[model samples]
Target: MLVFGPVRVIHCVAMITRVDTYLHSVPLSGAVAEQVGPFTLFRSTITWPYYARPVPGSEATITADDIELVRARCAELEIPLSFEWVVETCPSLGAAAAAAGLSVVEHPLLVLERDDFRPATADARLEILPTEDDVIRQARAAVNLAFGEGGTAVGTAGPAERDANAPAVADGLVATLRDRMLQGVSVAAGAFIDDGIVASGNHQPVDSTTEIVGVGTLPSMRRRGLGAAVTSTLVEHAFDHGVDLVLLSAESPAVAAVYERIGFHQIGHAGAAE
Candidate 1:
């Protein structure tokens, strides 16, 4: 609310709420390859809508021969691709996304640096423990609160307290992760407010990168430093590894502001393609 400078809506986020439109309505919907001119265009609805992995120099092809040839080759391989400005994490495919008329959607990070990240109530003790029980229980409670009952789905849910619910990693909707690590419970912390698990969050570590996701606070604990404290602890935990940058997406602008105060920038948007 007070952290971000101003909100920007280059596109209406509500457009893709249906969960099946883009993958079904678009021309290239789910086609492995589409024949257009000499180019065989491929398509897929994975990760972000406009995400891609391009073949270097090959992606730089502006000439009819190479460009068209690569398209056909890609089609033969049944590879579907979406174009986003490729990062170094990607193969150095020269502006293929740009060549395809895609622009660099700002990948935001912490716009500010370290500031005093204190909780609203210092009376309660916030402790981080390496386990998933707290996160799971809080997640279940949050889900129940967000939805009426039996609505445990994840992602841009109507609002944590409206009628929808928290967006989970799908396969493990009740499982708490994207991978198949059978990640028992989880590694997390519990924030005690007044008394009991008033706030809970989980920070998962992958190799060297860690993301402090699975944040949930009791209804009575809303608008407090519980989320901030849980997040900051994980951040400091990640910093122990000398992490250059920590990134995560926030659906609520109000909460995003809190992260901003702790130094997080809006890195554009993340879309779920049905």
Candidate 2:
């Protein structure tokens, strides 16, 4: 069920290089692009609401014409323009992106691998399950509740109320999740207890690496090791499917600590805006 690859741990710098190469490989669908000065511009359905950026260090200058070209392409697609810049490489792109009227969303993003991954202890007693059938429904509810998608508090009634008032929206979101799971666009795992899902996470695979995303534990369920279980389980799944490396971004130092406990090491920071 898996391909064989000699397992060798990768360093932070090499990992960043691989990430840049990965971006250029992303298939651009039904979109045209051109090189404006040192930067590259491409439009694609998969990268909706944003134009694509070349790998960091590959470009150095951004001209007014470059921004206008991006604007023109975005306008043609009837979507807004956006750019992603990794500070380690593209120091000038941030100012350029800002000048283009793109509101920058900057944060410290940590990268980790399985070598640094700390496994959850067995005594946690949480049943981590693959997202399938009804598990998808429960996992969807768990993610929304844990992430406070419908309200400021994790356990608030907003998610439930929204489900009740807008059944279609909720159902649509869950259905899309299901499709993504089935299509391998994402692999989801959920930790379930007596009540329902308490923790959930996803792995987004691109080429040789899989990105751990949406690793959230319900507020009430935190401090019990459920988050570690969800993350470890997803990492295992990605490896089983032949992914050589796994990466994720922590929202802050505190959150990064939680991931570090599970063997993920901080590599670098990334910037993006939409």
Candidate 3:
């Protein structure tokens, strides 16, 4: 069964609409968005691929046939067939995707309005990194390690593990991140100690809206509030830079609670299928 957040009622419908529109627009900068049936297929023009999303405000019922059409298009393009949507807004798509034999996961979706921003504390120094900074690779490496291990609980991977993986971090990814930063579409930040970055994340701004993503703390460094601190820095940076809304999808409810501590509230659930 696919579970979602508590924003499925009528009162939160407008927010859900706004979020759907924002998400549909975000990938346009780097992907060619094609309207296939009731879905918008974002075909990547860059190294990282994008996913299909339901057309905002479309009330068309999502049948397995619609999913199949999108899947065929993805296959023709040699890209994986995947979908992401705000479950509250596109309530029917999740079941359709699942019926089409895709594995789906529901993420706790959250957002922070400018007025709700709350700063968090961290023992290490935190700062936004410049595009040309060499530390960006290490930061990216740390994030990969964090996600690879997955979850909010503490584990063994940390600075040493990140260092071991940094050299293997693809230059193309680093280049892409730098290019996005240079274009004013993204900003990267990290929590640092003498050993190096222990947690890293970035926010991608599209006009007055931004999504804080890729936030991860080194596994061994978990439970120290570094992830929250990095997220706080990103949120503050986004607000200071004219972003009015900040959004993110956590890996689980426990992880979502971490964001809740710093003032984000659950708005919906982000569903993904592949």
Candidate 4:
């Protein structure tokens, strides 16, 4: 059930962040856990892999040496290092991270309260659907209308666009997204009225926390409440599944405002430590 740990929404951050340069999930076996500074890292594959704290720790402050050790380990593994955390700031630590030439991945970390969440307006006939092979194809067509041809072109892909910079389609990724959907962690809806998949996103489930991810609405469909409806529909389903904490990262206050109307609160802004 642990697809991707510490998943912040891949909204506009997807445009700037490649921290997922690795894949999702760890191997069934325990990932190698090590200590660097005060932070702990759990890793499976060495090169460009996903990692997180092996376990929560009580200590908070870390020394410069601690950061250097963590970096040295990442270098040993030949993998790109990323920050998996939540704190006020990391000025010194960020500088250390940068001196190592670690690729910067900044984001506006977001969270939504389960109890306070609600959709803005119920104008659209929203539907909660599963991920499918054809879903990407449908998403492409719908996004063309919603986000416009420029930014939404990422949807034009259907399996062939996985790692490429072209549109957002990829064959293997589509299959993966489908599996995540069936796992009850992903969803995409076709807008017959809108004429395509006007909305699509995935839920990265960690323990009981579910982060609404990959949430995107077509530009043509903007201001019609489709974004809020699609997101609300997904949150309702997550609640039904017994998830209590729903979080996502948003880049724009406009987008954040939609989630705000639905029962989510602005917990804080999460960006680079520096």
Q: Estimated TM-score per prediction?
A: 0.45, 0.75, 0.95, 0.64
Q: Where does model 4 exceed 4 Å of error?
A: 1-37, 42-55, 63-65, 89-110, 121-125, 140-168, 185-193, 272-274
List runs of model 1 lying over 4 Å from the truth: 1-123, 130-186
Report lDDT per candidate: 0.43, 0.63, 0.89, 0.52
Count residue pairs with overlapping backbones in model 4: 18
Q: lDDT value for candidate 2? A: 0.63
Best candidate, TM-score-wise?
Answer: 3
Return the candidate ranking by TM-score, descending. Answer: 3, 2, 4, 1
Residue 139 Cα positional deviation in candidate 1, in Å, after optimal superposition: 5.5
RMSD, each candidate, Å?
A: 12.0, 6.6, 3.0, 9.4
Indicate whether candidate 3 or candidate 4 has the larger TM-score.
Answer: 3
- Candidate 4 residue-wise lDDT, 1-274, digit = tens: 4243344434324422222211112221225666665655667532225543312333344444655676678789776556554333332444445565554444455556565776544455567664556656556444434334333223343222212322445565556556656765455543334334555554555545666765666554455666677777777777777777677766467667767778765544444321
After superposition, the stretches of candidate 2 with alpha carbons farther than 4 Å from their true spots are 1-11, 23-51, 55-57, 63-65, 121-133, 149-169
Superposed on all Cα atoms, model 1 deviates from the true structure by an RMSD in Å of 12.0
Best by lDDT: 3
Runs of candidate 3 with Cα error greater than 4 angstroms are 1-11
> Candidate 3 lDDT, tens digit per residue, 1-274?
5555666455367676777788999898789989999999999987798999988878778999999999999889899899999998888998999999999999999988877778998999999988863688899989999999899989999889998999897888788888888998789999998859999999988888889899999999999999999999999999999988899999999999999999999878999999
- Give me the displacement of residue 25 in model 4, in angstroms: 10
Error of 1 at 2 (Å): 17
> Between candidates 3 and 4, which one is better according to lDDT?
3
